[model samples]
Target: MLELQCAVRRDMLGLADGDSSAYVVPDSLPPRARLGIYRNTATGALLTALRLSYPAIRSLVGPEFFVGAARRFIEHCPPPSAWLDAYGATFPDFLARMPESASLAYLPDAARFEWAVNVVLHAPDAKPLDLGRLAELEPAELGHIRFAPHPAVQLIQSAFPVDAIWRAVLTRDDSALAAINLAEGPVWLCVRRTTSAVAIDRLAEGQWHFTAALLAGCPLHAALDQATDAAAHVWLATLLASGYFTEANLEGQVSNLPSGDPAT
Candidate 1:
């Protein structure tokens, strides 16, 4: 029974030949024909999840091409989790490794952006840090301050113009998309969400690193040390105003919700 089950599973994933000799057919039906239906259905379901999760990729490649790529990806990277939303953790890497899209180099980064968007959307809610209270802290005590990034704060950086491409595809702005030069830039973006909607914006180098350090559990002053050419106080005020930090330095400890897997 175990051997038969293994064979069935392999056949279902198109890893083995679904020969008639391997199985008893009902009503003398053709084994290959029967197996083909199940195989196609399973592949289709997985493909649908990829298509939904990475709409920017689908739109850029076109449905036919994206489906072909997704099928190949699904064959190797089956979901480890039963939750479809939680699957495809490795899809951006899969796209990056594909030789066919070597010319469209930004494709991988665009996939990363879309994935980050989904993650931000699903992240749990947290109350904003009380800025008024923060202003009351003594300068000496503030130096050791550690900050918590909201659960939805996601940091994403790409060597290509991923942010522009993702935005164009999502908004269906064909002209904007056409005007995008993939070689124009390496973008650093912060993607965050609130009850109303998700927002994606480019960040300065210092800002990006500062947020990254904070999210990685660095203390406030230590994270500030990672910044470049910026007044830590003013910039930090902007980050707080933008709703990045949730809470800061409680009982001499600063803590925040996990900001999903880091996007590079």
Candidate 2:
């Protein structure tokens, strides 16, 4: 049974090896016809999920073009796991390699932005920081502070105004899409899930660097300097409002970061 299932999957994905005759075929359908049906159905299902995962890509390339390229992309980079939401993480980079995408350089970044949105939507819910607890800390304790990034947080920086392009696609506003200049950025963005839904926000240069450093395990004091170098820092009250950092640690541990951590 296992071998037959493997054979069916191999044939469906067009990755069958030689000795196709070795697998026993059902009497009702010819082998080639059955294989073709399986292949179409499997690829069609993948294409639908990919389109849903990347609506911006579909909008930019149109239905026919997106489907053709996505079919080819799936052939080259099939999903590594059955979890579809986590799939296609590498698709934006795959788009960058396509000759058709050369003329539309922002397409890859826009795909990445869309992918980030999808990821955040499926991320585990996270508690926000308790500003009251943070405010009580002595000034000297700031140096030892470690911030815990929310699981839903994702940071992105792009050479093009992909954020604008993504927003236009979401709204289906053709005029807005047309007005977005490919060279308008270097845009910095952060994706985070709110209690009700996911949200993306443009970030200042300093804010991005600061968050990036914290997200990478940099301590509060040094992250402050890093953020202040590129942008201004107003400190914890303002930081908590962004919903990026979920907890503040002073002595190497979370005191308590409940899902319902009270807001100030």
Candidate 3:
């Protein structure tokens, strides 16, 4: 049964030619023709999943071009799991490598940004850090603290203004899209789910580095060292207030921080 399933999957994904002998055919329809129906349906569903996850990419490239590119991607890289929402995580990298997308240098980054939003939208929920407990720690203990970022938090760095491009494209603001300066340096963005909606906010380079280090499990002092600017503490405070982290640890011990007002 497992072998048959594997064979069917390979056939559906275009990884192998259909073996009509393996399928029970209707009297009127050829086995290969019946199999093609299933294959086409599966392909269409996968394409829809990609379109849902990458609406900006679709808008940027138009329906025809996006479909062509997406079909090629689906043929080469089928989803790894049953969860379609988790599919296409590597699509941004795929776009970067596609020869047809070479003219749109920011296309990959825009796809990446959209993927991050998709990830956060589907991420598991968790309680935000307790500000009251964090405030109780001694000043000396601050340097030894490490934080666990919320499950929905995602940090992205892009060479082009992908956020701006994503916004313009999705909103269909042609003037905003046209005014985008591709050479506008790099952008660091934080994509997180709020209580009611998803948010995409830009971060300063220093803040980006500091938050990245913390997300990587660095202790407070170590993360501060990675900050390129003098406002490391300010950045940390702002992030904490925004509910970026769920827990904080001091040294090797998990701090028993009670759930308090995150805004505090």
Model 1, span 1-264: residue lDDT tens? 877776767777777786433575565567777777888887888888888889888989898889888888888887765588777768989988999888887788888888999889878877777776666578776767677768888999998878888888889999998998877867889898966888888987777887788777677777777678467668777887888876677335434222232221
lDDT of each: 0.78, 0.78, 0.88
Residues 1-264 of candidate 2: C-alpha lDDT, one tens digit per residue: 887777777776667742243664657876676567767888888888898899988988989989888988889887777787787889999999999879887888889989989988988777676666766677898777887877888999999888888888889998998897776759899887878877788887777777789877687777776666533456344557867777776656755433353543
Candidate 1: 10-residue stretch with minimal lDDT = 255-264
Model 2 lDDT, residue 201, Cα = 85
Off by over 4 Å in 1: 1-11, 14-36, 130-141, 247-264
Candidate 3 C-alpha lDDT tens digits along 123-211? 99888888778778889988888888898999999999999998899899999999999998999999999999999899888888888
- Estimate TM-scores for all models: 0.80, 0.85, 0.91
In terms of lDDT, the best-performing candidate is: 3
In candidate 3, which residue ranges exceed 4 Å CA deviation?
A: 19-26, 135-139, 253-264
Query: How does model 2 score by TM-score?
Result: 0.85
**TM-score, predicted candidate 3 vs. hidden true structure:** 0.91
Clashing residue pairs found in predicted model 3: none
